[model samples]
Target: MERKLFLKNGLAALGLAAIAPLANACKKDTSGSDTTDTSGTTTTGGNSSTTCTVSPTETEGPFPTKTPGSLVRSNIVGDRTGVAFTIKIYIKNKNSSCAALSGALVDIWHCDKDGYYSEYGGTSMQTVDYTSNHFLRGRQVTDSNGLVTFTSIFPGWYTSRATHIHVHVYNSSGTSLLVTQIAFPEGSSSAVTLVNTTGSSYGYTKGMSGYTYNASDNVFSDDTAALETAVVSGSLSGGYTLTHTINVSA
Candidate 1:
């Protein structure tokens, strides 16, 4: 799609929720450091020769924020409730030896604590009608460090897929570069398990009984998860902070 068209459109309409045929309800990390495939990261001077691997693009389907440009802020929690979540994304330029890609447009959106999305809803995949709502969605421009952070709630799970976040990166010129998703950590000690386990207070109703694991997710099942997952830290009571690195060839 054209860059101008994408920005001008804003979240005016909601994409159809992918249900039934959805490969995975949801078929859907690491920490400070980038994936092993990337040689290294830039230093404080921002002049180091960091060669990051080009991350594979993923589908932006089911639901993508219609007008991301309209919602530009660090705190995207709009009337939604759940465990506080902080998302940090670092975008690097693989084509330019992995230098920090400053001024890049980084937009992210995810489901609420109850497996519902804003703007468009009421589909088989999503029963609630949130067509007029706009939560858990925002856009920001990467700073000198090629980083943009967003404040939201720890996303809840749906069927067929694992808990994940959708990210669309655009160049400084607003040209779409990569559209990918960030998977969360699993296991008993991981935040994903803790948040889902406690539903009464947090509003996370589904729990983990029928939850989908990353291994069986249709999107990340292709083995690209190594680079797609984020390194999450913190707690169920204290909230969680996620840091992920996205490498783009542009």
Candidate 2:
């Protein structure tokens, strides 16, 4: 686990889609407003917030079978070794124009600072450290507008590609209708350098450009300059923000 030497060596290579509208309701208030007068005083009131209500919609597959998972590593909660960062995935069901999708599940999983996966019930990438169970994974449902958010740390950098997160969007019926992964821009030198510094020490491979970002992954057929990057915020101690939107309904 040496420092400078780890960056100079080490290399490894390998590797490897929506819904419908429910219902819409429109209420027209043609009647005039009612006013009350008392002692030369008048008062009027109405609904302050607009509400969108829809009828029951059909359920689909591949959704979570049990409770949701967690993406943040519990052990590294306060670790300020420059290896910590936050990842926030924004979820929305654009297909539901009539009403916002509520209770729509979103499951996300990624590697840890050491490039390891929890595997849930299986094993891949690295061994399944029981302690890491559900450490870097989580499941959340969209709110009234089909929106959900998860607070996790930035993923570690592996060989041959930029930092990315694997996302799964499922309906209430546990059917996984959409499977996709989003990546950050390869231009963040500071973020890339941090990955290289932390991962290199473990004898892991280094990024071709000394940083991690998109624009290099062959899997992202739609990988464009704009789509490759995401918005990240946070401090080196707590973590950073990772925000990106994917247009799946289109």
Candidate 3:
């Protein structure tokens, strides 16, 4: 009889132990009910990253990337040949109508008189000693009055794009707020021929197509005519005068 009583008591103890684990599991579920899904998975907390989008007009103008070089280069006609030409860029916050934008940064790059651009990887652009950094390209910061100047050559015309300089403006924060290519007006036949010959040597497929206007450029369709002026005064042996005004919208 004692043996039977011991067996019955052991059975009851085993059953109670199993019941205890079940009760604990139920308690845990109830405590976290608010966080668990029907599939028993815990809900995610707010720990993910997100991206912010901003429109172009809301940003300010660019800050200077480099100090203005004190080198007083010439803006003369004689500088366009094997020599490098210099240009003074005027930065403005507003267009010709007079809007005020301060602290604009201007970045400029142009091809050399030989129709070669720096970083294009060719011997024709520079001299054998590589001293001719002929493609005059540089950046400047607009003062409180909005002006930046650079020393560059009279860019020879390319097949599709005419003789032009590319300018990119950004706000202080490095945001690209504006992009425009400045172009030169059509000159005498000799000037046109020079551009065509140099451009052909550089593998340009198309010849100059009657100096396209601002309305014709695919990228700068909305740019103002006054902003796209071409200043040409003379040749590398002589000198030339070309002035362009860029008007930016507020």
Model 3 lDDT on a 0 to 1 scale: 0.39
Candidate 2 local lDDT, 127-240, one digit each (tens): 334332455566766666555566555576443334566667767776755655555533223444334444454333333333322333333323232442455544344445
TM-score head-to-head 1 vs 2, winner: 1
Local distance difference test scores for all models: 0.72, 0.41, 0.39
Candidate 1 lDDT score at position 87: 89
Question: What are the models' TM-scores?
Answer: 0.80, 0.54, 0.48
lDDT of 1 by residue, 1-250 (tens): 0001111113332333332233323322222232211222211111111337887688785679998889999999999999988888999998888888999999999988777788876655457788898899999999999999999999986655678899999997889999988887666556776677764588876567656677766666677777777778766666778888889977
For residues 1-250, what per-residue lDDT tens digits would candidate 3 score against the true structure? 0001111112321111110111112111011012323542222111110111111111111111132243223332223344234555554444434433467666666655444454333232232232333335455667666666555444653222335566667776657666655644442223333334343433332334333333343322333322354444334333233444444543
State the TM-score for model 2.
0.54
* Model 3 alpha-carbon drift over 4 Å, by segment: 1-84, 95-97, 122-135, 189-227, 234-238
- Relative to the unseen true structure, what is the C-alpha lDDT of residue 120 in candidate 3, on a scale of 0 to 100? 34
Which consecutive 10 residues in model 3 have the weakest lDDT in total?
1-10
**In TM-score terms, which candidate is top?**
1
